[model samples]
Every structure is written in structure tokens, then in C-alpha cells.
Target chain A: MDHYTLLNPLIGGILIGLASLLATVLSGKIPGISGVFGRLLVLATPDPPSVAAATYGVAGKTWRAVFLLGLIGGAALSFALWQSAAIFRPMRPLVVMAIAGLLVGFGTRLGGGCTSGHGVCGVGIGAKDSMAATLIFMATAMVTVFIYNRAIL
Target chain B: MKAGKLFLLLVAGGLFGCGLAISGMTDPARVIGFLDLLGAWDPALLFVMAGAVAVYGLGMLVLRRFASRNLKLPTASSSPIDRRLVIGAAIFGLGWGLGGFCPGPALANLGGLRAEALLFVPAMAIGMLLAQRFFGADS
Candidate 1:
């Protein structure tokens, strides 16, 4: 764990927040990618709110497709840049990793928006729910880490 | 209008992804490893924030010139920063300190196809949903 590792959390947090704010100010969307995905998954149903009137009801299927595609495209672009420097570090046990993934997906649905939706977008505009969601989310995380290190580890 | 917004998002997303990658944020190992320092930690990530701010500031200035009076969004906003916020940021920080996965990176890492994030993300979502129901989401 050199320096870049630490930078990820703090700097990452700030950049993420900034990106979200800019996206909101410029595009009027909060950049809640996960929420976007959710709409995409459930787009089969007619969106209750009209697009112009509702602000963020259900987006068109085509737009969702493109949004999802942008996610992939962004990743690809980064991978292309970091292609060589990629450091495949030692991984947690596959079992552990898998469990973590399941937990995260479950948490996302339960939480409403992952960190981006609540923590960044929500917090940016001063949403009460985002704040509460982020608080509980963090508390649970802290307890889990403490347990993992002191007892589980 | 939707098309226009999508175009902007597409560009922003690309820039965001690039920022994460270039800032060395896409790699969780880097983050988890860094957390090894409970305190007396490096502020490298802070610099990343500064850089990103510079970029965002310039971007915002340019965007302001676009002269779009602005269309209202479906997304919710909270101006007061009430108890929920104080509590939420603390909780989010705790989770972040422990898991090294917050909102943006969680999504970006998912885009990178990291299997670990696959789990953390869902659990995170569930957590958010729980907040929405109990706390009453910003409808």
C-alpha cells in the first residue's frame, strides 16, 4: 500500500462529488448511474411521469441503452490508458469476493442509490434521505470492518 | 432536449471514467491498501480532488456560458443539510473507510467488471433502499 491507494478514498470521494455536481449543473441530472440502470431494467412499464414535467421519471429505453453503453465505453477508455500499468494485486479469496459482490448488490437496492446516488448526488443538493442513507451506510460499514479486523480477521 | 442532455452525459461520463483511471482511483487494491493507515495517512487522494476541482471549475465556467436557462430535473435536492446529512456523511465515511467502496468508485469499479464490487454494490443498494423506506426517500 504505497500512496496511490490512499489517494483513492479521499481524492476519489471529492472527484466523484465534483463530477456529479457538474453533471447536475450542466445536464440537470445527478449522474446517478445506478438509478439510471434501474430505470433501464424496469423501463418496460410506462413511466408514470411525463419526461418534461417529471424531471426524472422513466427515461426512454434508447437513452438507457446509450447510458449503459457509455459506462462500458468509459471503462474501455480507461483500460486502454492503464493497459500496461495494471497491477493485478493479490485478491481476496474468491468466496470472499463473491460474497462481497452479493452483499453490495443487495445493499444498493436496499439503500436506494449506491454511494454515488446518495452520498454524492444526494449530499450535493442537501437531500435529507441521502444524508441519512449515507450515515447508516457508513455506520454499518464501520462496525463490519471493526468486527472483521478484531474478531473475524 | 433529452438527446442533448444525453450527449452531455456521455461526454461527462467519459471524462469521469478517465479521471478515475488517471487519478488511480479505479483500482480498489490501491484503496484497501491505503486504508492500512488508520490515521497519519497520505493525502494523495486529496490532491486528486484538487485536480478534479480545477477541471470541474473550468468546465463549469464554460457550461455557464451555454446560456441554457435550465430545465428542471427529476432528481431531488435537499437544501437544509439537516440531521439526515450529518448522520449520513458520517455513516458513508465509516463505510468508505472500511470497505473502500463509495458511490462513484463503486459504479466505476462495476464498469471495470471487478467481481468484488458486484457484491458490495448490491448490499449498498439494499442499504440505500432501507434508508429510503425508513427515512422516507425524497419523493
Candidate 2:
């Protein structure tokens, strides 16, 4: 890869790390996208009263909403400024993308985290479960990619 | 939850988006490129993750130093390895492979208002909700 390509991921990684650090230090949160978003989903759903109600409370709900909004705002701002910051193309059919999203959503919840929570923040903290989850998911991702591109495609 | 904490959370979220966008993680092509290991594999994601882990690992150390505060992070799950974790991760990996976008980048790409990302995000939300409703037992 070119030097520019290498630099961008590193810089972005640092920014993400800083964000994770800030969230943990200031609010004792993990800045995990799935965890944060999942909590909001559970809260929004009209499920029977459960642990979430007591856990999220008023403050919990409020902060999560704000944090999610900030994610969009930050991305929008960067898009406007960078213009070419995001190169989004639909590489697969709509059905495929939708199904993928569903699996990701379900898997993250079932697994208790996503790339951000389990791979980044979880591994960073040296949590054994997170480490295991990351390793398993990483291997699976590679294998899936191999199968899709090589076998299926 | 408080105003100050809310503000901090907002900043954190924004910064997280910034990192994703800047690092090129927001681009599905880049992610797919990285995953295409047998072919023209891109190692950029490896470095991106490395940088993030370095900083976050240090942050964990700092938090550990302040362990007396009883910091109960939501990210911490005391559960062991089980069928749920393995199966869920495997399915998630398959989905990620099918669609190059992960939850974080997909959500962040909403900033650009990409049509495909729009389609993906809602579907993901529905999936999360479904999992919570049906699979709350497993978690």
C-alpha cells in the first residue's frame, strides 16, 4: 500500500483510541458502537420491564441518545470537510446487505459486542472473553471473506 | 447522563466518527480490501487497529490505577465462552464478509447519507432489536 493509505488508518486509529479513552475516563463507558446502540434499541423497544430499565434509567437513556447523535454529527462534519472522506458503494445486492446487517445486529447482541467493543476496547482492556471473541470473529471474518470471494463469487 | 457527562459522550462519539472517517474505516472498499487476504490484501486495517489498541491499552492502565473508584464499565461482561458467543461471532463474521460494512462504519457512514448505508443501518437496528427481544435469554 502507499504511504498515504498507511497513514490514514493509523491516524484514524489514534482518533478512535482517544475517543474510547475519553468515554471511559469521563463517563466510565466503553464507546462500543454496538453496545451503545443496542442499549438504545432495548430501551426504545416496549419490552417488559427488565434489568435495562433500572440500569439505563433517565440518565442512561439521555447520554446514549446524545452519544449516538454525536456519531452522526461528527461523521457529517468530516464528510463535509473532507469531501472524499467516505467512498460508499453498494458492492452487493440490497437483499444481501440487509441480511448482512441483520446477522451483524443479531450476532453482536448474542456475542455481547462487536468489532469496537470486543475487538478494540475489550482486547485493549485484556479481558479474556473479549480476546477470545476477537480472535474467533477475526478468524471467521477472514474465512468468510475467503469463501465469498474465492468459493462463492 | 448528567449534562457534563452528556457533553463528554457527544465529543467522544464525534471523535470516534472522525477516527473512522479519517482512518478510511468508513469506506467499505477499504475494509473489503483488507479482508481479501488471499488476493490483493491490504494491511492498512491492521495498522489502524494496532494504533487504536495501543492508545486504548494505555487508557486501561490508567483506569486500573484508579480502581478504587469502582468503575463499572458496561463493556465489561463477566461471562465465559459459550455456544452463544462462538455462534454469534461466526454469524456476524459471515454478515461482515457478505457486506463489507461493520456496525461502527455503517452507522458512521450515515453522515454522508449513502443510500446503501441507509438501507444497512436500519436493517442492523431491526436485527439488534430482534435479538434483544428473542435472544435476551442467551445474553
Candidate models: Cα lDDT each: 0.53, 0.80
Chain B TM-score, candidates in order: 0.75, 0.91
Q: Which candidate number maximizes TM-score?
A: 2
User: Against the true structure, whose DockQ is highest?
Assistant: 2
Cα-based lDDT at residue A123, candidate 1: 52
Assign candidate 1 its CAPRI class. acceptable
Question: Tens-digit lDDT track for model 2 on A11-80?
Answer: 8899888888888776666667888888876655454557446435666677777877888888888777
Candidate 2 docks at the CAPRI level of medium
Which TM-score value belongs to model 2? 0.91
Which 10-residue span in candidate 2 chain B carries the lowest summed lDDT? B67-76
Q: Whole-model lDDT for model 2 versus the true structure?
A: 0.80
TM-score of each: 0.64, 0.91
**A1-153 in candidate 1: lDDT tens per residue?**
232354444444454445555566654555566565544444223334555324333355555455446555665566665652133342355455544544454355445565556655565445677767766765566555545555655
lDDT of 1 by residue, B56-92 (tens): 4444445555646563443454445455445555555
